[model samples]
Target: MHIVLQIGSEITRPTFWLIGPVGKAVFYYLAAVAILVFLAGASERVKRYTKGDADHADRLDDLPSRVVESARTVLSNRTLFDRDFVGGVMHLLVMWGFLTLLIATIILGIDMDLYRPLTGESFFIGDFYLSYSFVADAMGLLFIVGLGIMLYRRYAARNERLWGHHTSLEDDLLVWTLFLLGVGGYLTEAVRIIGQDFPPFETASFVGWAVALIIAAVGVTPELARTLYPITWWAHALLALAFIAAIPMGKPFHMLSSFANVVTRDGDAGKRLPGIPADLDATNAETIDDFSWKELLDQDACTKCGRCSSVCPAKASDRPLDPRNVILDLKTYREERDAGGEDLPIIADGGAAVIDAATMESCMACMACMDSCPVEIEHLSSFTKMNRQLVDQGDVDSNVQNVFQNVMQQGNTFGDQARARADWTAELEFEVDDARETEVEFLWYVGDYPSYDDRNKQVARSLARLFELAGVEYGILYEDEVYDGNDVRRIGEEFLFLEQAGTLVDTFEACEFEKIVCTDPHSFNTFKNEYPEVDFAEFADDPMMAFEIEESWDGAPVYHWTQVVEELVDDGRLGLQGDELAYTVTYHDPCHLGRYNDEYEAPRELVRATGCKLVEMPRNRNDSFCCGGGGGGLWTDFDDEPKPSEERLREALEDTSAGDAIEKFVVACPMCMTMYEDGRKTGGYEDEIQIVDVAELLIEAVEIRDGRQA
Candidate 1:
């Protein structure tokens, strides 16, 4: 009988050799088995998430918004695209091709089993069917191309981001399985096209038609082609089933977990650190159950991309910490526990620990890892949580413990008396108003280093002069202003931070300041972001709470001095008076201001406003390198050969060495100033470079304009 070809004909392939019924039955059975296995494995992995503590539950409050954001993140691949464009494009192409093919598969199943059976006619048989066929064929080719690129990247290119660290058999399995599956699919389509008597319109399936033409030129008879069709079809079908079954078995599992992670990510990246539990002596998280559910999900969501490790300052400085390995180790521990292994100690005596203590301490809490992470994993939170446990166990570094003790006893990391807080005001030409005894428009919250350290005190004095020149109605709390506790909180001393913050909040309540401003980015970050959640009842009767401020303090507005200076220059409040100094300047972005608070523009603007030639370091803005002073690094010294600060200094010097050279390395944070000053002397760049705060630079420019010696 002559087969009739309908318009756009969906019946491109003939029935199976073992009869259509048998073929359909076998296909459905295999599909069912594959799906069951996939779901079972997925469920087991999901169950482990419940072992973690509750966190980011608020993420579910705005479900629709979260879904839209998640969809946008996935479809646009914004995180990867913005950070690594080439790799992002490769990933995007493969992702789109796979999704399109998945849709085509579902449509084909419906057309074969439901539409044709019920209507006695194929739905995908007309112009729409031809279009669908063309699309499917084109996408299949695209998928193959994407797979080839991935193979090249993994093997030929040997991408540093992918290889050279902790790769496993599972990683190879995932790539090879997908590669083989794509090849098998394309070959099956070619065999079917050659065997069947398809119409001219069906040739719109270009790749398949081309393959068929090649087969025909090879003298393959129609009968031989038909014989090969069933063999190729079965092979393709089994391979597809195997691919689906392996989705939740290994690295391929990221396909699902990553999407879920993106959807459930914390809305506020700046406020990622969870508050310490109220019980001061409460046990830290010892097991997987101790972490928040989002944190546990972080383990599964990690793509092993090594982006986190690549940007980690500690890792770059040859510290014991490798963020990628830390996450992978946690994942492995979870797998072991799920497999009925003994409860593995996260930090054991002699046995393998999930993460060693040294790695935990090595974290600088700079948020670089979190910022670089495409999946938005809370790596810093993990470090802090683990550190909290270590602290409770009295296993913290001696320097860190000393910092904790000083902050608790002396209200500052330096153990200086509260009376010495306003010592910097002594050299100011103008008598600074005391906010405690008078109302002021701006309350200058001179943080620990600016108030106590000699070098930082000079910067503090310069800032006070700038405030005066701008005619800003600002005053200091003097001795009443205790430490803001930004570093203390980060050091895993939550209770002490609370006490310090509470005392400061109370003092602010008594002061008649409209807004609080600080020269230190650390203080700026803490007051603006963290203090609102401080519980006052705990410090109500404590002697440390001796501040006389009485009104309800719900965290007033806070601004960094850079922000204030930017406003002053914009408003024409501060006039630049002196000759533009002939100096090449490079600005260092402190971690808190740049990444933690997203305040990059203001400082750079302030620098440029001074008429100094601003040369940006290779890494600036959100990608800026840390000075190793954050996370209590200022007080707690590590045995790093080239400290993070010194490393950053070298980067600046190298950028400026060729030309006019960097005359000054301008900074905005007191901690950064301290770190880089030491870096200047230690790195042997003291003759070539001088470290100064943005305020100092601005003051110099202002003084020169006034025709006075700077």
Candidate 2:
């Protein structure tokens, strides 16, 4: 191969240099060992993922599309670049360069060792060789530059996202090995060029050729370069082998695991969580085996970017939960279980654990972490499963426990009489329909917060008046409606959620309605995605329940009131003119509404329909900050001072005061109305930004229409 390569005018360097047969043999021998080590470790990790449930519907449902999406996601690096531009560029350089170099090495291996040796024909010379040499050197330099940035961020700049919660020597080792490997490849090339009498065609190895000039400029003779060549050559080769072996042993494993995680990601993961399998019960997962295979895969896929923690409502409010720590803790426990360690509580705080009870409870279940996570680890879903275990184990907070009890016992979170669910309508001049008796277009599932909460009740009453005035045929469940169990399911009270969902499913079976609608995103989410999956053995005989198999709207059509109102306003029946009640208002997206269902636009469209100037917060739409209202947030207070809602109010405040005062912080969800209402009062921004529901705004528009007509 050396004679064949040198005879070709030296456009490409030798695959091996200044090494005898014994050296080549040793290199191949170590290469085989590295391959073995990598396979053994990788197989074990993959085996762990497989041990969990393999029943994920979205995992292999659309393999072609999934593969295409995965390819697009990785290539575009959108998730990696979510909030950090420099980090995105850094990753792109490293990822593409590293992948390219790997491909070049494989091509060289096939031509030099496998293909050319057997076929006795060499196509790896001439134009292809020259082009390959230049490309390889250029990519290697890029790879080194990326590594340099990463190391600087880690060690010098001390980027919190990289260094947060935990840092192991293996993490540092993986990075340094990659950095040195790139550096060593160029050094080896420089030495080889020194020995080859500066072949003019060697200019094709542009970076390496420049390195050679520097080496010769430092007064090293060609004879001396020849003496130093073997050491540099072996070092580079060994470093490359080490990289392969070390892949699954440290953070480098994310290269494979994260890609697979993204490819198999559930499009509606946090929004529509996987159901617990028949065999497993929700007890705080004592061991890794308790989690589903996909959840196990999620743990391995974490890149520790801390985007989750940074965006976490709980963590920002001086809460104990660090979203990154949740994954890391689970990962450490898995490692222990693999090492034959006995099962124990992973959530107990204060004693050598990555997560604690406080941490678990601290999660407002906003899903900010999952949304911000580049790898799509399904953080909120995994944590919810663990929370189920906690509830079953009686390790839940008092406030959260009360919420579960109230929801199950009273058909609502307030523990009020069922008749009280309809009491809000008494305040309205017009009567609301009982959907069970009357046929209606929308079966309004009046969620607990909208019905029972004093502040939200006004918003609900206003919506009723607006509906009546618009001649919209919508009726509510009234006394029969149970909590939708969206947040109940998320808060980890699985049995409670099922029981409540079963009751609502049965109610739907009896009701004559075209669609289910809610002022609560939580209710809308469950009715839309989860209600159909409930094993309603009692209602099993029905060919179609009202909520299920709706023909008027598509599969399991459920909508937030904003969606219905958007259509109503578009019809021009409401007579909404933007100038009529034009108030410069910013909108706060409810987590369940925007991030969960991808319904950010409907509410905003309604705002525009009402003639309000829709000013936006910095974090609006999918990236909108949570109002500390989902999951168990409505019932509990884990933070020393409530921050998610108040912090969100501050963000809204910055977008206003253009010429007139910001009239209102418009919201679409009842839970958001409650949260931001409290946020305005506590954050001392009551005078600065008003909290008003989208329904309230629409009602105001309706009054304007009525006044103009009179």
Model 2, runs deviating above 4 Å: 1-5, 8-10, 53-58, 277-284, 348-354, 538-556, 655-661
Question: What is each predicted model's overall lDDT from 0 to 1?
Answer: 0.80, 0.80
TM-scores, in order shown? 0.94, 0.94
Model 1 C-alpha lDDT per residue in residues 1-710, reported as the tens digit of each score:
24344424344433344236878798889999999999998997888777777783475778788889898989887888756787787787778888998999898788778987898876665667678878888887877887888889889998776864569888888878777777777777666666665457758788878877887889876677778877888887898898899888888889888888888887565454677655545556588778788888888899888888888898888888888888888888878787898786675323476777777777777999889888888787777777777767677788888878877778788889988889888887779999999889999998889999999999999999889988999999888878888876776776677777777877777779899998888888888877765556645555655544333357788999999989998987877632456668898989999899899999888888888888889888988999988887777667887888888888887754434377889999999999999988887878878899988888877867777544
The residue pairs in collision within model 1 are 577-705, 578-704, 578-705
The pairs that clash in candidate 2 are 283-389, 284-389, 578-611
Q: Please report, as a residue range, the 10-residue window in candidate 1 with the lowest summed lDDT.
A: 9-18
True lDDT of residue 332, candidate 2: 85
The alpha-carbon RMSD values of the candidates against the true structure, listed in the order shown, are 2.8, 3.4
- How many residue pairs clash per model? 3, 3
Could you give candidate 2's per-residue lDDT for residues 233-302 as a string of tens digits?
9888888898899898878999999999998888778777666643344344655676778888888888
Instruction: Give the C-alpha miss distance for residue 184 in model 2, angstroms.
Output: 1.3
